[model samples]
Target: MLKPILKLLALCAFCWAFFASADVLTVRQDAPERYVVKKGDTLWDISALYLSEPWRWPQLWRMNPQIDNPHLIFPGDVLKLVYGPDGRPMLVRDNRVVRLSPRTRVTDTRPDAVTTLPLAMIRPFLTHDKLMTAEQLNGQPYILGASSNVKNATEGHILYARGELEPGKGYAIYRRGKAYIDPETKDELGHELNLVATSRAFRAGNAANNEPASLQVMDARREIRQGDVVLPSIDGEALPAYFHMSRPELAVEGLIIDTTSNLREFSKWDIVIINRGTNEQLQPGNMLNIVRPSPTVVDGNDGKPVYLEDSSRYQRLARNFGHEQITMPREMVGHLMVFKVADRASYAIVTDTFRPVRVGDHIISP
Candidate 1:
């Protein structure tokens, strides 16, 4: 179920103050006067149909307080665009209803309401990825062996692990992935626990007797091999039913440390890992702008290749000719919203991309 509608409204009100500029609402030129909410339509997708920036959805909802439970949107509901008293555009629900005697009308609505983004795209990251500190990585239980003394195991195989574990509980099998390092500070942020498979603890281990616990492989994304670490399955409760898109409360400057599936270049709808999280006060729903440094080139040169500030070749040529360097302004390539926050890193999904974003790109408050 989604959070209480009142809380969502309050969050929208709080974020309204942070808008960079106060311009009249910019509705799309092709915006429809009335739209019927359809199945599989997300709040963002619907908003994009009317507003230039879909993240301003909460703002659009806030304009019409007369509509009850506006955030609990359902399919078949009719949304009509009307002007408020101040001549500002607002979206109002126009569900046809009969005015019978004073009584609460009951109707069956799906428990899963329309949310901000497509849940299917982020479900795997929510279920499979877990960031771990060095200590936690070292302390996790690892696969000892498989049934019939096999070195590798797959689904339906019985595997043995050595560690303290609760019987009959589900756990995720993982292997240590790349360690994240801050591009600017060069500090080790954390390591990624790449999920391999899932298993249920059939028997708990006895540390005093040096006995290993047995597990039944319930599912496999790949072969569940010996030496793979086992960690508690990430809870589905982490998936919020609904959240408002907002900017981080604090000023945070960080880099895109990595991408999901080791992608060389990522665009809209892709998941990325950044080096700022709880440490930088990042929270779910916070939006960040992906920025790329503009190229710097030799001044007064025709078709010369772009050069870095510290390029030795540029330094040698500049010393001889005394030509100045021209640095272009940084440009924003994309926008992303944080959906999960860890200790020193966070998982964000790309919402918009003007150009392909890459690792090492900088992220700033939108």
Candidate 2:
């Protein structure tokens, strides 16, 4: 059911570029020499057994050109860690189908595979309208004046929209989630848009005649309201359950602006928004390391706060000022991969979390 991912036209090339690794990665000391693929075994699962940093699977997996795409990954396949001619570690006798197969694709040989994360964890975010800025929402088709005279309407309610609507077509109702900003630069990234409901056009509107369209709400998570943005209905069929893991073409250093659930203890499988995106040459499947920033602590010995930076300056004035800021090391708190990228923001899910991801967390090379 996974087509060539053409649906992501904006990033089809970048998405497909995920088939290979850009760098040589490190392997875990306790990693097994061989692993057999099993049903329900994700790429992340298999990669974890071999690499210290599991997100670098692309590097170790760069062995066989065939297995790069990984959509064809199947159970019962044997994988062994063997060195290549260059004396670097790589998988041996592994059949990996990188995204692009220049030769004729032989569908008869491979098995269908799922993604690194559970589908339920990311299904809600697989839409085009997840990130919307105020400027982008301007003049967008919206609910005319609310579904009805009532304050809020639920399922089976009739709604009206003030924009061009095609007869028999469908549209989705969405509300803003959070105002995301760049943690480093303090620039507004964009607003997270949530799909509130979906409706079908029983009637169509004409811009020339200023005629409004009527729609019957088919589903509603909450209330559909006036001024709510109405966009093309999300096509469930177009969603890609399989996301090939790849490394970023460029160095990615940014901050976690927000979490999807806004929990202080951000755990695994949680969706998040970072401050990097297409502007930084990022694309879907690019892996990242969620670096937790160290807190500044006061220097107890001198009775002054230890300054992490300006050590020489502190050394010169320490006896006189009794104050120094101590810099802490950034820890590898979690791992994530970009699934969708907007102009200035991206949506990624935490693949693994050693600690809770918070706002302003560092995102560096994986």
Candidate 3:
């Protein structure tokens, strides 16, 4: 009986040791690292590049006070990864600052370096739709005369008009309409303005010719503009420019595959969406950081040694078994960002980890 009891105790000790070692491994694997700063970048964008999650950037950033304004990282800043004597990756950046010379560029005066588009040719591409009403048109501070001096106007008819203080010679016309709303919530979002027609002044009239001229409504409606705002229209779809703002771009190497909002919603094969798109100037072959939540304090009493309730009756035995049992806080797991954006809703694959990632997990730009 004594031998059997000793064997059982040994087995329990072995199990505890194994689990403790595993926990340490998990912590080390999740530790942060130092990252070098490059040009055309900001701290917000940098943080998203290295860490599992971008929001937790404050943690790694707090480690470096030399960063001063958080926006001061310039090109050629050397970031070192410091570790403890135990070889464990400790806090990132010790706030050491190293500056380097800037890169110079060569200018080319060749014709290949310059391209121009004629205004006449570009005008067609620059037009956009606007929505308006007839009443709103009459209320406009600018009006010279109606087509054929008519009191009423209909769609597709060019109105001889003058603008406020200036003769309306080359101004485009549009009609304002109802606001757009969300299909489900019916919440008003934005106005759906439509373009009525383009107007060209045949005769330049004096500003004093404010006879409350009627403007032509290109698209006919039951009633003309009642209360609508008029704004200049652009010609065609606009392309997104390079995002130089402190936004994260693919900086390092990694793949994204999963995402989660909470432990209950965690999945290994979950999908994630990136803000980058073709319109945003993103292309194939870019990498981004997959972020996970930073470790947080869950319960203070956790990890404390505890004795079994049944053993409490035996004061001496309970005292020998220790005061309480300790359990570590639960850690939330997630994926890293990988893969270039294909469209507005590009998909990424979660590559690593045993846990699920949450929504709002960010992919930092490299």
Candidate 4:
């Protein structure tokens, strides 16, 4: 009897230590008893309703066997709260399907079908913008002039460009902007691009010495000017394949290089590029946290190092020449999810911004 009791006590102590070492998933106090899935809803949006930390959705999923896969939930699926064998709250589906038999049915309603996310929100970004490396875009075809040499070219305009243009092939026009560099190593990663327009050559190709090829603007997002680059147009559906969300399997860290609008400060729904890429094991759907580094400061009382914000009191005491500056702790400003990935860089849109994100903001694993 004494031996059995000793073994039981040891097992209890081991279980306590293991549980304490892991994160405790916190549920919302006022979590809904049931949530009906909607067409425009995403996993992130639905998870937020029941979990305090929506990023830890995998934890909630483990407790519920009914919600085997999030991708299977349709628009009309009803998520009901249930208790697991362990007495923990679990989100289970109480699916209800209503079949419609119309006299002249023409289309498949697909009431049971589901989508990974709200495609409308990310559809614009799928084809419009891209970052290019020096070796990739250098010496490529470029717009040399516009009709009558105007500073800007709009729709229904003719543009002259020097390149080997096949008569029917379409080209995407891009305006190159600033070079995005790594904040830590200060290396040029890639050049920022603004897609201006796309056009197909109509007349003919121009030789190296002959007049440049003539093309008509088929679509215009902005001003297509002389000196803009002309590259092959990407298929509209290529990016949507990565729309399925998946957590990052590896740990990663980096900093924001720039934004789609070229703004210094970032806002909600802004597309931003981060320095990390596939080389760092980054994948599409990997969520990251945006953080601001703490400011460095000096102590007023003694010639010692201190980490604090610059205040009026500190300004008066800074006349002393020996005060040392120290860096303060990092603070989270927002959260971002990677929707696209390249070799050394990836593009992410700000999903939740507690504060406006800026260039050079640190990106850390969530």
Candidate 5:
């Protein structure tokens, strides 16, 4: 009798802790009982209607077995919120097929399901932008010269390249951008390859005979110049439209190394590259919180402290000359979701911003 009583107490404690952990999924008081999924509604937008923190959507979907895969929620489906037997909120989807006729009946319309984010915002990065290693960039075919010795060529111009080139094949022209270096260790990560133009090989180069290949520029976003790299057109991976939003299982942290627009400061929806990637156990759909390191303060003689932002160059250096300095607490500025991961770095778009973010800002697992 004593053993049975203890077992029941242990189970009760375990159940209590399990439900208590979900307190963060606070449902809004004005949340509707049921909502009709719309054509343009995103998973993030829909989740924000019911929970305060929309990033915690995986928790809400887990309680309800009806929503096996959140990505499959169609536009015409109906979402109904109901409580489970354990008194936890569950979001249930009603995707019943509507019959149009008895003999020739219509099934459920499975149109393009709503993605987690606006695909238009990230489609270009997914297709064009890429990171290349130093060796890879150096080995690719380069524009040796242009027909008629044109210094800068546009569309429909013939250019000659000297490398192993294939005839009748499409190639993407790229200009070398900045080199990504780890902020902490100062190790060279990779070089940013900016897509400039695209072309097709009119004639293959023969390295054995020292013959250069002929290429005709098909499309030009910018003027194609000599020394521009020519590589096979990047047919990027087939990534899913909807990303499974989740935190990293391991503690991961890094600094923002670069931005797509080359802006000094970035905010929501801006694409930025971080120093961490698959090497750091980061992957697509991992959300990280951005933290801005606090500036150091110098204590002056007049019973006041001057922040580094307000201090002069001389005053900032005076900290080494017996001036007391204090480092303030770091602040959380925003959150970013990793959309693409390379070997040593990853591309992430700012999902939420509470303050202005800059390069070198720390990104930690949420």
Candidate 6:
């Protein structure tokens, strides 16, 4: 008789324990009680540093709709983090909201000077073009140098070669290369800039084989110097109008507000992050696409996968697998692209296994 009763008691105890350990949404405890907005600070950066994650900022801000625009949380605004019964974090604005009033000080007191001149127009110059074969030109190893003290060139910086390989008095130099990230994370955030440019070769090689050449800045800023890797310019027609302009603004749609788990592997065709929000233009139920990095293969014979080289055992396996001749110990895997976005950290799915989506997958722009 007691045996059945004891078993029933044990079952009830197990059920109680499960519910006790389960996480239920409640007010947070350690809410940031204070914050001072500074110049040039974006709400994204502040949310990441103060909250568990930046994407959660909307939830925190939703607690108080009177705060107005989320972007309006600008410099001089004071923020306060609050907590409720569940021990979750919440945000509040303090008396500092009134600091946005206009200032009376004016520093620029000088009178404005007006000058009007008809727009000066210069006639376009007409020149003859000539083509030279590879044998007609003398080629020298190019050395790149920089004037901005940056070891690696970035966007808008100028780069030039210091060797003698001249056509006329002044010819243009340009760079064309693909941009990628080191230790590739297969995430959208990991993508780095791949810059290309074209400029004129200035001072001719006057003295020795190692002499420097005079270079002039044409389009981009002239900062990079000899020893920087650059390719010869390619002659082409003008690019499309959209190529020179910024991308169009995307409409805010939906968001991946919550995730069931934190451990996720991102692959191709996974949703990453979304920019829309309640404050922006996003709402619930809108759909967004997830993107992942394209698959890359490495060979086994090579040492390893480096930025410029992919010589790994995996690469060899991939090659063998392509032929379908025999089975080798080669593995095919993918990468993830994470967008830390300064304050907001999110990831996109980079690999696809026809399995369940995980935490670190992408939620891309909609």
On TM-score, the leading prediction is: 1
Each prediction's whole-model lDDT (CA): 0.81, 0.75, 0.40, 0.75, 0.82, 0.38
Give per-residue CA lDDT, model 6, range 145-183, as digits (tens): 654666655445433465664533434432222222212
Q: Which stretches of candidate 6 lie over 4 Å from their true place?
A: 1-29, 39-45, 48-50, 82-89, 96-174, 178-193, 196-218, 223-366
TM-score for each prediction? 0.79, 0.74, 0.27, 0.71, 0.77, 0.28
Please give the TM-score that candidate 3 achieves against the real structure: 0.27
**If ranked by TM-score, best first, what sequence of candidates would result?**
1, 5, 2, 4, 6, 3
For 74-130, candidate 5 gives per-residue lDDT tens digits of 887899888777777878886563434445633334658777887777877777778
**What is candidate 3's lDDT per residue for 1-366, written digit by digit as tens?**
999999999999999999966433122344345555554444434554455444244444443434433434445555554544544332343444434335633332332211111122222212443212233344453433344545444565555443342334344454454543333344333333444444443444445754433344444432223333323333344422111222334343222222222243444333344433454544432334456544322222436423343333444334434443333333335443323243332334343344555554555553
Listed per model in order, the count of residue pairs whose N, CA or C atoms clash below 3 Å is: 0, 21, 51, 0, 0, 62
**Model 3 poorest 10 in a row by lDDT:** 112-121
Return the lDDT, model 1, position 150.
71
In model 2, state the lDDT of residue 103.
73
Model 2 ranges off by over 4 Å: 1-25, 38-40, 62-69, 75-78, 84-88, 92-114, 145-148, 154-156, 183-187, 207-210, 234-237, 241-244, 297-322
Better of 1 and 6 by lDDT: 1
Q: Which candidate is the best by lDDT?
A: 5
lDDT value for candidate 1? 0.81
Could you tell me which 10 consecutive residues in candidate 2 have the lowest summed lDDT? Answer: 106-115
| Residue pairs clashing, model 4 | none
Clash pairs, model 1 backbone: none
